[model samples]
Target chain A: MRLKCPLCGDRDAREFHYRGAAKLMERPEAGAGEAAFYDYVYLRENPVGANSELWFHELGCRAWLCVSRDVSSHEILSVELADAVKRGQA
Target chain B: MVDLTGLSALEGLLPYEVDGAVLSAVSYGAITSIMPFRGQKTAVNVRLKADGGAALPRIGRVSGPVAKRLIWAGRGQYLLLDLRRGAAFDTTPDPAFDELAALSDQTSAWVVMRLEGARAQEVLARLCPLDLRAGVFKRGHVARTELAHMAVILWRRPKGFEIMVVRSVAQVAMRRLSGAMDSVAAQAVLGEIS
Candidate 1:
């Protein structure tokens, strides 16, 4: 598998590390119930189809990437710099 | 003061010449890492242009005066090298850029080497996985990749290429680069024989 880095272009997958889901998790506010905190920490939706994930280009640009991919088919739909995505510029 | 003249990482292995390339250590006046503050990319570029005669290089590129080169070193970072003198870090903080960026001396942290010759690209191809064809990786292009399992920064020059690696792995890098050079040289000789 290969990932097209926005800065470095397409590179082998060995240069990147697979981080987990890319969805932003909301932390419970102070005094929020334990159940809410527990769910935030432990619960994750196991989507088998298209999923947004985070990856670290450890050996390439050293940028965090948000990768939209198909979990079952391993098809990468898109890759964007995580910082740009968070800033709404991607 | 301690005698530090012979303490360079490539003290003994440099000035190595092989069949198609020459490997030599690069002496720089200063090497600094510049990281722009949040939302200060334009400010940082202006400051760098005033100081180095060029703006900060874009990703996968290098730019600057002949004496000083600014190499893109990953997201929000650049490695500025002054090659005219061999002094240590001596740049006074520019107040104009103080709020726009941060500068850190990286002179002793990295060891730089230059590989140049007609067949230098072939030697590099033996170790690095990047597509280094002349058209693909032309002069002024930069890439951060692994060479022999060690992280390295590579930039193309008009005559050849420059490689920068952390000081801790300088010996290993040199060995691997020399090995690749030897391998390519042998292949060229075999091709002629057959």
Candidate 2:
């Protein structure tokens, strides 16, 4: 699949590594409960749709990217750098 | 001469404490295939067009005694390979398999970190199936090896070595690697870790 990286331009998926949804973990809330901690560390949520997920370029320039795509249609909605912190997409 | 991460923790007699090479939280990009090629004094890395799109990047050929070593294919396009080193090529000829191979190759979501220090070899030995001894591995070598029980591609550089494993294996690998380096760090510099 092809992803348009906002900073690196359109690149094949081979250029990046998927890290899952942007924010999936909360740094164990200063001594959280056992169940809550287990959920955060052990469980994973796999969703299919247009979701904002995190990615890294392990092969290319090594940049952070945000991508919105469909699992079925193989269509990409949008892609940009890890600039979500600067643009406030976070 | 400089101590690095994990140095002081081992024997506790280390000049200065070194941490081996800690994961800096930097991104090495997603799973990407690396192509290593070389000529006489130069080496080039090119990422192949693995999706059945043939993009052959042309580089000048090696220079030798023109009267002898000029074996010619004449009109055909030449792809340069540094015979001094082993070259990696895209072996996947299947389109459907390319997408999945990309993921296995970490073409989707992954990070690559370069780990080296006085404790480099010790750290790698703990989790890698490959031997990290200098006698077996000199400089300018690369391999698709395994780390922390995951398939990885490791390239040996001058200073130390660089390893790329899956992101999901990060925390676990780090714990094991750090502990391993902490086991060493007594004498050598472990080299520079980036």
- Could you give the CAPRI-style class of model 1? medium
Candidate 1 collision pairs: none
Name model 1 segments beyond 4 Å from true: A24-33, B1-6, B86-95, B192-194
lDDT of 2 by residue, B1-194 (tens): 77544311122321222565443332321222322222311111112333322233222122222111111111111212211211253422334433222212323233445576656777787666555687766553444444655555455545566554555665565556556666555333453432
After best superposition, candidate 2 residue B98: deviation in angstroms? 10
Q: For every candidate, give the share of true A-B contacts it also has.
A: 0.69, 0.00
For residues B70-155, what per-residue lDDT tens digits would candidate 1 score against the true structure? 99998788988887553554655456767888888787789999999888888888788888878999989999997877889998
True contacts reproduced, candidate 2:
0.00
Which 10-residue window of candidate 2 chain A scores lowest in summed lDDT? A6-15
